[model samples]
Target: MVKATINNFESLALSGKTLGSISYATRKSVGRKSETDVAQVNLNESLETFSIQPQSGFDFSTSMGTKLKLVNARLVATEARSNGRTSVVQGVQGSLLPVSDPTVDEYDEAEYDMVFVTGKNRKPVARVRSKDAFDSQDLVLFGSDVLYKTDNRNQVIIEDDEAQKSGYRLNFVQSKIKDDEIGHLISIIISVDEYERLAPSLKPSQKYVPQGLRVAFVGNETTNWTLYADTVVPLTENNKQAVKVDSKPNSNTAVKADEKDMKK
Candidate 1:
């Protein structure tokens, strides 16, 4: 048996308060049992919230509204390789360790891949790939086929938490993957400008395909689930057109002249 793995962020630390109840969900399929315990926490640096799963049987005694800092947390992607060229993605593996820390925000802060951590002017302390390959973003986001969209004036955390910026967020499933058929889904956050520009075309009456900025663990590397584009760029119309043009067969290519006639 061969092992396949990838590590992008070696360390992930965040200080935030619990947003909602931490619940454990049980998912059963065929002969397997899976734990779907997820924690919804709000970032202390801002009001942005994200759901992350924790280790099994973790202590959840920490009640809501308590200041917590994620400790010993990292993002990893795994795959189980069998015979040559035969393997399957094992999904993202890692756990969030939110330890109570009341003074987490007391320290001057820095940003890494849009995630805030304690300390001032702090750069990336650890990375999986070379500095050029991985800096802040080690995740790729691509989306198509709009499932749902939020209010355009809603606030989303793309950069530092600041007031007065408004935009929209939507869940876009990859055009190639069916949601019911697979568990792959991507959430895209768009700037207000992008939203306004695409609003007319996005009417319910119009046929629209949306692609935007979203973070997702991808099997970009064979050995590990590491390496993502520097930024999550929404797919564009020109790009779509280019694909269609490129995929079509060339009509100008000359064909062989009458091979059967020559044989006769």
Candidate 2:
């Protein structure tokens, strides 16, 4: 997996580092924020301030699946650091001075300071790396402990197609599951295109799309599943053209007050 820290765009723009390099550096620095980390500790009351919302009614199961991979733009590197070096030079008296710098000859590793933001009002709970321009996704699980603290029903699924592209495998995890076999795994199958579409729907200030894409679990059972498109297409009557109405005559339609109106 490619690594990218917060302030990724600025780091890429000013310092000229690739996105992959930044991600690599950020993942190594620190543990991501937990749900409790963002919680507002109740000082006055012994009980923690808590609230709950009824989950919207929807079937949350899916079939085993695979899809095409997304493309990521590599930031252009402007200033490249030399790797740590080892060199020898003669002193004033022609005495040889051996110098050793372990990483001096290699590219200098990029550094980033982090910014922490608590999830509030439905925003994602996450730990972010910050910079002058924007905050990048360091780690994000969810908004509340109730979401993450529970036994996660998420599963990661990876698939391969032999006929289409040789040696290319598509990876996508089921978002919400019924009987999860694998332990909770972060779903990383979001395509770059999906990221672009979902980004705007989130708050204007929101920068990170942690999952890259959102997949709606569209069926009542795992076998009856279909991956909807990236955009949220509302279920409007126009799209329901094929939806069947009961052919059995209803009294309202059959027993029209005026026979002439029904005849037309």
Candidate 3:
């Protein structure tokens, strides 16, 4: 027989006390009852060999093994493989719980491709593709506000800085507009390569625009619009032309407006 001292009252069988004693039979029987029922005899022997002691908290131990403490309200076992053999080993959960791995949550290149278009068009114009496909009636945003809809077909592409360096290309269609109707100014955000190729013909007076500046193109005209390094001047409520100011500052001039106050 083995004697164990209970230190915690959490167990319903040993409640309302700081310490108590429980006896267990450790010896195995040498008779027919024991031979016919091996499982029960082994279970009783294991229960007697292991002891539970409570100090600051409960600690469980077998006579020949190290004590194990409960973690996250449960006991966990971990295994590692090496040289075609698997072995249970101690792990970080006992020391560092709730760990995070950044690589596990990172997006793959295929996922990035799903969000943008990759192709060619007849015209030399640049194109912007969104990770999401938009319908003609769907509203598209330039920065923080909606600038136009897919129906206009003049929206520009905005590529991430890292993505531009990878030589990804987009497709743009030539604008078709009637000569009688007033032409609308369409703006696009593009990579540096696309901007350099089209900049010469567009003849934007200012060559150095802000990193994410939008290049505005006149409807049907294709290559006639001013390029300024100033903040992106959004189109007016009528979507006819960009709202600008006449003042020029050091060659980098743009029509200015209270961007915050402008409505979508």
Candidate 4:
């Protein structure tokens, strides 16, 4: 019953100072120009410029420096080189800010940002923070919105006892996120390790009814995060009436398939 937080790597806020002009994302790799059905918006934060691809069609009276928020955003990897598809964010919706700065509290309670890093940094990433990452979260997958194949590729590193998969991220969300309440679609880059550590006990959530997968994070602040897997919590007839359940629908947002020649 916990509300998902925004600190997860799969969710992000773009253009700290308001960034861009929205335009159609097109591809010329399929032997002809084609529309991606998503808009490409470039934004800036702290002087860092980034281009984000969000599902288009929502009208925003966007001008320069308009703070934007994108949900269900993640990077997708492709094994082939001819798909002409860039790593995209599965943004259900992108809205203007005042949606709240994703942090410890509502308003600007705390700040969050990301970048590609290569170093043994301080505090195991966010251990240096006053609030631990995902301290206020209890993720549960109600079901997949659309579970099908696509043109994305994944690479998992398997070692002696475990493995880490980081090709497509698992995106979770609140059953009914309010339009103005700053709902966040958390995309956890969970590895196999998270699945190993957490056990399912059927401790019901106050925010979400027990229906699909009771998810958990595998790591801590010290080691950052590892696996993101579902726990086994079976519902019974005696208590089934008390819980609002969701059908175990298949789910998968990113599925980059093998790339090939100029034909599908």
Instruction: Name the best candidate (by TM-score).
Output: 1
lDDT of 4 by residue, 59-134 (tens): 4445545545543333321122236643322222233233364622222312222221112111111101111223
lDDT (0 to 1) per candidate: 0.31, 0.19, 0.22, 0.30
Q: What is the lDDT of residue 198 in candidate 1?
A: 60
The residue pairs in collision within model 3 are 115-131, 128-157, 156-188, 244-255, 245-255
Residue range with the least summed lDDT across 10 consecutive positions in model 1: 255-264
Model 3 earns a TM-score of 0.15
lDDT of 4: 0.30
Predicted model with the maximum lDDT: 1
The full ranking of all candidates by TM-score, starting with the best, is: 1, 4, 3, 2
Candidate 1, 189-232: lDDT as tens digits: 44445555665445321223322111233343322221211113
Which segments of candidate 3 are over 4 A away from where they belong?
1-182, 188-221, 233-246, 251-264
Alpha-carbon lDDT of model 2: 0.19
How big is the positional error of residue 62 in model 1, measured in Å on the Cα after superposition? 3.4
lDDT of 3 at 145: 18
lDDT: the better of candidates 2 and 4: 4
lDDT of 3 by residue, 1-264 (tens): 222111101101111011112222222321222221101111122443322222232122223223222122111123445565654421111111111312221222222111111111111111121112211111222222122221224333345622112111122111232222232122333334443454444423222112222222221212222122233222235333222322212222222211111122
lDDT of 4 at 255: 16
lDDT of 4 at 19: 27
Ten-residue segment with the worst summed lDDT in candidate 3? 7-16
Model 4, position 29, has a per-residue lDDT of: 18
